[model samples]
Target: MAQARQLEQEQGQGSFVQSVKSELFSPEKRQGNLNIALSLSVFAGAIVFLRNFGELLAV
Candidate 1:
């Protein structure tokens, strides 16, 4: 009984890992993530530039 329970647990874990891999490594998901990252980086850069604009004007 214990061995059966352990085997079931392993199967569950395997499926969980496989789902995670699919979600993370799928091409469409990867491209979406990349786009989100690029957009966030550009927004951060714009924020930094606006915050430092006064310093630039002073120089």
Candidate 2:
């Protein structure tokens, strides 16, 4: 009971971390945070595209 109360305080109200804990770190919650994901998508896309073009330049 006390542990549940402590979690709400440390992780913040309705935060990603708290939700992640609640969900037992499932893949769905792992992908829930958008800001962390955008950069990865951009990077992966850029890499794939650059490899096709044989250039490291940004599209």
Candidate 3:
């Protein structure tokens, strides 16, 4: 009935999510994560320097 249909749909969705999660978090994803971290660090460093440039100039 409706309950059985709902259970089947839930099982199907769960398997799809697991497959996607496995793919997304594979070894290749580690490299992507590293790249993102490096990019963010560089961006933050640039912003910090720009915001404190006056203090740096006074030194």
Best by TM-score: 1
Off by over 4 Å in 3: 1-25, 54-59
For model 1 the TM-score comes to 0.58
- Best-to-worst order by TM-score is 1, 3, 2
| TM-score of each prediction | 0.58, 0.39, 0.47
lDDT tens string, model 2, 1-59? 99999997777865877766767666676666565678889999988887898664655
Error of 3 at 15 (Å): 9.5
Best candidate according to lDDT: 1
Q: Write the per-residue lDDT of candidate 3 for residues 2-48, one digit (tens) a residue.
A: 99999999999999999888766888687887788899999999988
Q: Which residue pairs in model 2 clash with each other?
A: none
Write the candidate numbers in order of decreasing lDDT. 1, 3, 2
Which scores greater on TM-score, model 1 or model 3? 1
Lowest lDDT 10-residue stretch of candidate 2: 26-35
- List model 1 lDDT by residue over 28-56, tens digit each: 79998788889999999999988989577
Per model, state how many residue pairs clash: 0, 0, 0
Model 3 compared with the native: what TM-score? 0.47
